[model samples]
Target: MAHQSTHETVDARRIEVIAPNFKRRLSGVTTTIVQLVPAQRADGLEIAALGPGLPRHLPKLRYRDLWRLRRPPQARAQRVWHARRNTEMVGGLVLRDVLRMPLKLVFTSASQRHHQPFSRWLISRMDYVVSTSRKTAGYLERPSTVILHGIDLARFRPPGEKFAAKRAVGLDPNRKIVGCFGRVRRQKGTDLFVSALVEPLRANPDWIAIVAGRTTEKHTGYAAELRARIEGEGLSDRILFVGEHTDIERWYQALDLFIAPQRWEGFGLTPLEAMASGVPVIATNVGAFPELIIEGKTGIVLPDLEPSTMQEAASRLMKDDGMRAAMSSAALAHVAAHFSVAREVAELRAVYDAVSPPAETRAGNAP
Candidate 1:
C-alpha cells in the first residue's frame, strides 16, 4: 500500500510529508503551495502535494490516495501533514484521529483577525503552528513560529531598461507608470488607489496610472462605478483598468511605482513583489506591510488607507527623482537580504525537521 503509485505520481513510499490543497480554486493558499512545495522538494525534503488544483508536474497524490494515507512512508514511522486552511485541518484530524493514520499535523495561520471557536479548537490540535506575521500571531491563542512569505527573485528582478519595459507592455514610455494590482473590489481598496491617483494625475502631466486585476461578477457594479468615476474626471485615458493578466511579472517590471492600497489583508505579497521588481511602493499599514516595508528607506507604509495620504505620498515620491531612485535601490537590496525564497525555504525546513523523524531513524527502510 505504501508503494502504490498513480499516473504521473511520485512513488508514495518516498513521500515523508504531504501538502494538501483541498480547495479547487486558485486562491492565495494554492499559490503558496505551488511556489513553496517545489522549493521544499529541491531543498531535499521528500514532500508531495495531495488533492486537486495543483499543476500536473508537481509531485502529488490523487484524492483516491485518501486510503493510501493509512500507511506511513517506507522510511518514516510518521509523516508530516501541513495544512493551511480549515478544511485541510479537518481532513488531517479525521485522518489521524478517526482513521488513526500516522501523521503529525501542522497548520499555518495567516489571518489577522480573531478566529472563531471552532477554528481556534482546530488550531489547538496542530503539532506545530506557523504565523505569517507578528500581527497575525497576535490574533492566535496558541504560540506560533512567524515565517514571512518570499517570492522567486529570479522571476521578479528589476527590468534592465524602465522605458523599454514600459513600451514592451504597450504602455506610454514618456509617462511614469504607477500601478495597483489585485481583485477589483472595495475590499482591496481599488477605489482608494483610483481616488489617490486622480488628484495627482490631474495635477501632473508626466504620470499615468494602471489597475491590473480581475473584477469578479459579484463586483461588476463596483468596477463599473470606478470606471464611471474615472470617466467623470476625464482621466480615462490616463487611468487605465487593464483586466487580469497572466504575465504579472512583466507588468510589475514596467512600473515606476507600485501601490498596495488594501484596507485589510492576511499577509500581503504584492508590496514584496513590487519591491522585488525594484519598484518603490506606497502601501497601507495592514497585514505584513510594516514588516516588509522599511518606512522612509525602501517604501512608505502609510498609517491609514485614506486617499489623501496615498496621494500625498505618491505625489511626494513622483516629484523627488533622487528619493525615488534611492528607494528603488534600497527596495531591491532589502528584499534580497530579508525575503528571498531561499530564506523562506530554509525557515520552513526547520519547521518540518522539528516535527519529523530523524534521518537516521528513517533512512534504510523501503516498501
Candidate 2:
C-alpha cells in the first residue's frame, strides 16, 4: 500500500481525533491504535494516528502537524489527543498544558498493576481515562471507563475445514494440532505451555502442539532451553516451534485448541483472538483471562501456573469431542456478542463525545 506523504494536503481542520503511539516497538498499545483508527474513521469521525510504527494505509498526522492543534479542528471544539502509553500521555500534556493547545487529553490504561508516582501524575492530568478491563480499572486512582479490547471479527473467523487450514500452513492434516502463540518468553509462560503438553502429547499419537512466536535477543537462552528440553524428551516431531507469522489469524483457524499460559499480562488478547477464530482456549488465570474465558463454555481457565493443572484441563477438553465442539460454537458466539470491534469503536466515540464541545458550536463553525 502506498503511504500518505508527510506533505500531503490533509486538512488539519478536519482532524478531530489524534491517536499518538510514540513507541517504535509493536506492543499491545500499538496494536490497539492500528485496529481502532480505521474503525473510528468508518464511523464518520475524522481520526488520525501520530507516531512511528503504524501502517501506512491508516490516516496519520505527521510530527509537523502539531501546529494544527492550536486552532480547534472543524466540527469539534477541541481535538481529542488519545494516549495509550506514559510517553504518549506526556506528549499530550505538553501539547495541551505547556503549548496551550486546544486539545482534550484522553488516556487508556491497560496495566493492571499499581502505577508509579510519575504514571499516576500523568494519568491524573487526562480529561478522561479508559481502562481495557475491570481488573485494569481497579489500579486507577481516578474514574475510568472500562473498554475491553475487541478483535476484527471479519479477519479472524473460522476456516471451512480445520485440516485444510493445517495443510495450507504445511502441517499434517491427520493429526490434531494445538497452538501456543505470542512472544516466546518465561513471562509469557511459553515453558509452562510446553511442559504441560509434553505428557499428553507423548501419550496421544494423533495430537501435536505448535509454539508460534518470536523469541527476542534477551530471551534467546530461554527459548533454547525450552527447545533443548523438548529435544531431550525425543518429542521434537510432536512439539514444533514455528517462528512468528504475519498471517497469525490463519494459524489460529487451524488449531484444534489454543493455550495462553502467561504467568502475567496486562489485558492479554490471545484468548480472545483464539475464540474469535473458533478455537477453544486453555489460558492461565492472568490478566483478563478469567473474565474473557467463560470457564466450561468458551474454554478452560487454569487457577494456577502448575503444569499438572494445565495438563488436566487440556486432557479433559481434548478427549471430549462433543464438549470441544460445543465450546467452539460458544467461543465464536461469545466473541461476536461481547467483543466485536464495532462495539469498541462505538464505546470510544461516546467517550469522545462526552468530553468534546457541544454539537451546535462544533457544527456551526465548520466551513
Candidate 3:
C-alpha cells in the first residue's frame, strides 16, 4: 500500500488507481481500500489508525502508543489512545473486535521507541506486520515477518559505461573507488568504516573511499570523528567526503565495492541499491545483514565490527574477480526473486485473504 503523506499524496493517489490493477492480476480478486490519511484530508472516510501514535491531524479510528513520541501534542484532545501498558492484550482484543476485515500493517523502520511499540501492537491486531529486517522482527513482542524493501532496479542498474557515470557525478574515472552512501551518522558506523580503511590505504595508497550523505548535527559530529581518524592514520588524501546527493545510483555504478558497517539498521536500502547495481557489498552482520547478504551467495557479511574484519572481507572480494562475479550475479537474482513488488503483493494478498471475515463476522456488512 502507498504510504499517505502531504508530500506523497499525488504519488499515493496514482498508486491507489494502479494498485487495483495489480491486485486483480495477481490475486484474481477485487481489493478493498482503507484510507490512513489524517482527518484533515480524510474527508470523513473510515480509517483505523494502525497505531496509538497518530499522525498530526489524522482521524483516529483507534489509537495506541508503543513508541515514545518525539513531538508533543499541539493541543490535547479528548481522544482515546492505546496505552503502552498491556498493549499486546489491547491489540489482540481490537483485532477480534473493531477491525475484523482483511488487514496488512506495514512497519517502515524503527528509528524511535514508539514505532516498534505500535508495530508490536498492530502485529497482534492484524494478520501480519511486515518488517524490513529479521532483526526488526526479532524486536517485536508479537509474531512478525520480514519483507526486504525493494529498489527500482531499472533505475539503479549497472551503467552502460562506468566512466561516463563517474564523470557525470564529478569523480576521477580512473580511481579504484570504494563508495559509501547514506545519511552520515555514527549509528551507521561511519567511524568504524573509516577506521577499517586506515590499514587498507597503507597497502594501496591510490585507492579512494568516497563517502556521501547529508550532514545533520547527529551525523556531522560522526563525520568529524571519521575525518580526524583518517588524518591520524595519515590517509587524508585517500579519504574524501562528498556530502549528500540525490543521484546515488551513479555513485553505486562507479564503485568497485560498497561498504556499510552500520551498528544497526531496519533493512539497509543502500546495500539493495549496490546489489541492484551489481556491485558487491561488505556489510556488518548485525540487524538486517543476514537477510540481505547471503554469506557466500550474494555479498560478504562481516561477523564483527572491527576494521580488520571489514578490511579483510573487502580485500578478499576486491582481489577475487571470479568470486566477485559470482556474488554479483547472485545478488541480482536474490533481489529479483525475493524483493520485487510482485513478491510483496503476493504475500500481502495471502494476509488479506486470511483476515477476511467469515460469514458470521461480516453479518449485514457482507458484500
Per-model TM-score versus the true fold = 0.95, 0.95, 0.67
RMSD of 3: 10.7
Residue 300 in candidate 2, Cα distance off native in Å? 0.9
For candidate 1, lDDT tens digit of each residue in 1-367? Answer: 5864343567676788889989998889999998998888888888889888888668887667667767777656778999999999999999999999989999999998899999999999999999999999999999999999999999999998988999998999888999999999998999999999988887888999999999899999999999999999999999999889988999999998999999888888999999999999999999899999999999999988789999999899878889989999999999999998889989987887788765664464434
Which 10-residue span in candidate 2 carries the lowest summed lDDT?
Answer: 4-13
Off by over 4 Å in 1: 1-8, 361-367
Ranking by TM-score: 2, 1, 3
The C-alpha lDDT values of all candidates are 0.90, 0.90, 0.57
* Per-residue lDDT over 66-159 for candidate 3, one digit per residue giving the tens place of the 0 to 100 score: 1212221222111112122234335444533564412222322332233455545554554345455666656666665565555566667887
- Over all chains combined, what TM-score does candidate 3 have? 0.67
Residue 179 lDDT (model 2):
94
Cα lDDT for residue 55, model 2? 79
Model 3 segments beyond 4 Å from truth?
1-123, 356-367
